[model samples]
Target: MTTTKERALDAAICLAGSQGIRAMTHARVDAAAGLPKGSTSNHFRTRDALLAGVIARIAEGERADLAPAARGPIHSIDEFVDVFTAVVTTLTGPHADRTRARYALFLELSSDPELQAPLRAQRAAFAELARILLAGLGAKHPDAAVEAFMAFGDGLILHRLTVDPGAPVRRSVAIAVRGCLEA
Candidate 1:
């Protein structure tokens, strides 16, 4: 019941999730989407085009996740915690195995430089969003605050990926945030 374009992006997301960006060929995507094997090419002439679509979809989701903070003054550190918690929830899932697999997907992304540009840009956008949030935190150097927060948050995820967390991502973020900021 979906359009060819829809099928193509769906396939791209699932393929990239399961096999990483490099393995997301037209043939693989078509098979994943349950559409004709040539539909990826029919909708997106090249791999770049298909990958672009995938980035667009994922970035859109990321933006949606930060919708509230993006629009308002994110002064309360508590509010950032809420937003970061939701974002981490999406990455980690409600289950431990899903969280581990999501971390693996994060690893898969690191291996695909060609497909990482859009992802990098989206990350910049999130950084800018954090700058806006930092302005509310009474920090004179918004850029520095953004960098610090992102670095700490990312390190937390990477550490959790390699550790056996009894309380999981929500707890991990809480601990990281507490350590990253002062009372």
Candidate 2:
């Protein structure tokens, strides 16, 4: 079952994604989450704490979403493509709001030193997972491949979120993964 904290964090993410970071106040989160007044503040004492909660929630959500792919060694490009496609589809589809909120949080992170470490750790973990997959594909330089793949994915996500919502992110990600595997 989703806990009160989880609900509040989700509300913050949704609020930030839909209405920008400025709209993610405690009262707004409470209202968005259908919690009583001050509920969010009770759980998150400060804005930094609330923001941290959102970041943690994003990381946890990503890890859960990617767990299937991480369960075993990826033995083929198709397997990798499937995993990438699933991730892209979620980011551009059902979870698009969360993804947008994450981007907004990411932009805010640049100015919030307190929140940087967790975000960096989350990113490093994701890169490490990409490296593992790239290694399975016989990538000449798995580290470099991971960086390039992450860059491409991030750019594609940003484009989808900002420039063109109708972009074929799943197809584009599949093609990119295939190209990376072939290189």
Q: Note each model's CA RMSD in angstroms.
A: 4.1, 1.6
Model 2 error, position 39 (Å): 0.8
Q: Write the per-residue lDDT of candidate 2 for residues 34-150, one digit (tens) a residue.
A: 999999999999998999899899888888887877898988887788888788778777888888887888787787767977778877888898889888888877777788899
Candidate 1 stretches greater than 4 Å from native: 94-116, 159-167, 178-183
Model number with the top lDDT:
2
- In terms of lDDT, model 2 sits at 0.85
Task: Estimate the lDDT of model 1.
Answer: 0.66
Worst 10-residue lDDT window for candidate 2 reads 174-183
lDDT digits (tens) for residues 1-183 of candidate 1: 868888778667766655555767899888888888788898789876876676776666667766766777765667777778777665544332333433444566687876676677877887887767666666566666677878876776555445533335566555555544532
Candidate 2 regions exceeding 4 Å error are none
Pairs with steric clashes in candidate 1: none
